[model samples]
Target: MGCFEDLSDQELITAAKGGSDTCFGELVDRHTTTAYRVARSITGSHEEAEDVVQESFLRAFKNLDRFDGSKSTFKTWLLTITRNQSINIVSSFRRRALKFFSDHEEGEPELEFASNPLSQEPLDAETQLSLKRQYHTMDKALKKLPERQRTALLLRSQESLSYDEIATVMDISVSSVESLIFRARKKIIELVER
Candidate 1:
C-alpha cells in the first residue's frame, strides 16, 4: 500500500495525463469534497451538487492536456470547472423557477430555497427546524436584494470564498467584491429586521 504523497500537483497531473489511472483517482479523492462544497453552494441541491462535481471532474480530465501549471494553480483550474458547472446547474434550476412562475402566479407559494441563508451553523436538530422557518422569511427578504447583492451574499456567506476568489468567480475587482459583500450584508440586516 503505497501513498502518492510524494507527488507534486504537476507530477500527479503528468502521471494522470500519461494514462496512470491511479494518479487520476488520487486526484479525484483529494479534491472531491472541495468540489462538492463549491457545487452545493452554487446549486443549493446536494443531488445536483454531486452531478456537478462528477461533471467537473470529467471536464477536467478531458481537458487535462491543456492545463498549464504556470498560469494558474491546478487547484484553481479544477475549481474553475467546478464553479462553472455549479453555475450552469443553478441556471437550469432558475429556468425551471421561471417556468413554474409562468404556469402559476399570485397563488403560487414561494418555493423554499434549498439553501438556508443564516446560521452560525452546525445547528442542532431543534435549531435546524427553528432556523428553517426563519430562513424561509430570510430567504424572501434576501430575494428583494438586487442581483449582485444576492450573489455576493451567497458567494461570500455560503461559499466562504475570499475576496480575491470571489473576484475571480465574479469577474470583478477585489474592491468591488468588498463593496458588493458590504452592500449585501447591510441590505440583509435591513430586510430581515423589517
Candidate 2:
C-alpha cells in the first residue's frame, strides 16, 4: 500500500495475485522494453515483435499464479516465455511467407535482419556497403545455427543473463548451456571466415 516502486518483482507478483492491478501494471512497465527486445531479436520485425510481446504478457498474466519463484526469478521466467513465443511467431511467419513465395516466385530464401541497419549514423558510402555486407553474412551464419544454440547465445550475450539464469530459462543443465554456447561460437566463426 505504501510504494510499489520500492517492492521487488516477487512482492509485486504476490500483490498482483491478491488483486492489485497497480502492481501488475508496474510489472508490465518494468519488463515491456526488455520483452520487446527479446521478441524483436527472434522476429526481426517491429510489428511482429509488438504482437508477440502483447501475447506473451497476456499469457504470463493469466498464468501468474503458476509462477514459482523457487524454480526461477520472475524475469527469467518471463523472458523464457517471451523467447518461446517469439520463436513460435517466427516459425508461423516463415510458413506463411514460404506459402506466399511458392504462389509467387521471389528468389532464394534469405534471413531477414531483425535490427534496423539504417538506424546507424551515416558513414562513407564504401564503408557502409562493406559493413552492410559483413552484417548480412554474419546474420546468415547465425540463422543457420540450431535454435537452442542461438537462444543460449542471445540470452547470454544480448540479455546479459548469467549462465545459471540461462540454464534456468532454457530448462537445461549448466553444462549443456556451456556446450551450446561453445558450439554456436565455433560454428559462427567457421561460417563467417568463409
lDDT of 2: 0.82
Off by over 4 Å in 2: 93-99, 102-138
True-vs-predicted CA distance for residue 15, candidate 2, Å: 1.6
lDDT minimum window of 10 residues, candidate 2: 105-114
Clashing residue pair totals per candidate (backbone < 3 A)? 0, 1
- Predicted candidate 1 versus true structure: per-residue lDDT over 88-157, tens digit per residue: 7666867578667787433422333343447534546776677778876876777677655666677678
Model 2: residue 190 alpha-carbon error in angstroms: 2.4
Which segments of model 1 are wrong by more than 4 Å? Answer: 1-8, 93-161, 191-194
lDDT tens readout by residue for model 2, 1-194: 54368899999999988878888889999999778877766766667778888998899999999999998988998998998898887778675787677775334333233344577654666775777798778668877888788888878886789999999878899999999999999999998888
Clashing pairs in 1: none
lDDT of 2 at 148: 84
Pairs of residues clashing in candidate 2: 44-114
